[model samples]
Target: MDFRNLWPSLDLIIDAGPIIQNQGNRNGSTIVDLSVKGEYKIVRDGCAKDQTVKILKEFGLKEIHD
Candidate 1:
């Protein structure tokens, strides 16, 4: 789960658990956080979104329809 390079200059990272939460599994919320750039630069990086979703799927966070 080394996503450092994926999100370079990451500052504040908060653990969101497992991306999914329910009555049976409330402790499985995926890690989502607010990252800020150190310098005054504008960089559009899509790796974070892609990698996060991939990681969630890898961790068995299946979508439920009820």
Candidate 2:
């Protein structure tokens, strides 16, 4: 099935944990925890920055961190 355009149509709760430690390097090198809840639960760790930025851009969601 074609599901590329499918987007959630429910209330979503997103939570992000603080940076725990630096993973050696200084280029955004740290471990972070994230969770998203809607109809299902989604969890991620470490680096999801790139993908998250892309998704946000796709939805024209800028100034999110500002």
Candidate 3:
């Protein structure tokens, strides 16, 4: 997924801290940290095939998947 287009206004923040132990299935789960909004977890499931889209929508960001 191209995050640059997905979150155009926000900058990605990478934390060098120790990886947090993820609970449950890690297959399609991703943890993203944004500059202004902090961290958000996008988990893909049967009900929600495109979790990133849902997250963007939740934050009132325009959907621009690449």
Candidate 4:
């Protein structure tokens, strides 16, 4: 029941409810929040830039100066 070891990869999302329940530390931040808020934002925002790389990669648009 190690919640620390229940992170989801980009290739798949595993259900970590049991582990979190057993560990008794449900802050309600599920795997989706972890990936979407943490890793997804990192790749999207470039982590070193002020813009979203995902916008350029997905739509071939340049910097949105707004």
Backbone clash pairs for candidate 2 read none
Q: Which 10-residue window of candidate 2 scores lowest in summed lDDT? A: 33-42
- Supply every candidate's count of residue pairs whose N, Cα or C atoms clash at under 3 angstroms: 9, 0, 0, 0
Among these predicted structures, which one has the highest TM-score? Answer: 2
Clashing pairs in 3: none
lDDT of 3 at 27: 46
CA shift of 45, model 2, Å: 9.5
Pairs in steric clash, model 4: none
Per-residue lDDT over 1-66 for candidate 2, one digit per residue giving the tens place of the 0 to 100 score: 864454464234333444344455223322222222211111333444544555545766542220
Q: For model 3, give the 10-residue run with minimal summed lDDT.
A: 40-49
- The runs of at least 3 residues in candidate 4 whose Cα sits more than 4 Å from the true structure, single-residue gaps closed, are 1-12, 17-24, 31-39, 42-66
Clashing pairs in 1: 16-29, 16-30, 16-31, 17-29, 18-28, 18-29, 18-30, 19-29, 19-30
Query: Residue 3: error of model 3 in Å?
Result: 16
RMSD value for candidate 1: 13.9
Pick the lDDT winner.
3
Candidate 3 regions off by >4 Å?
1-10, 13-49
lDDT of 3 at 37: 48
Question: lDDT of all the models against the reference?
Answer: 0.42, 0.38, 0.44, 0.35
What is the C-alpha lDDT profile of model 4 across 5-52, one tens digit per residue? 555534555332342332343333332223332233232321223223
Per-residue lDDT tens digits for candidate 3, residues 12-65, read 553344433445433433444332343343333322235555665677764322
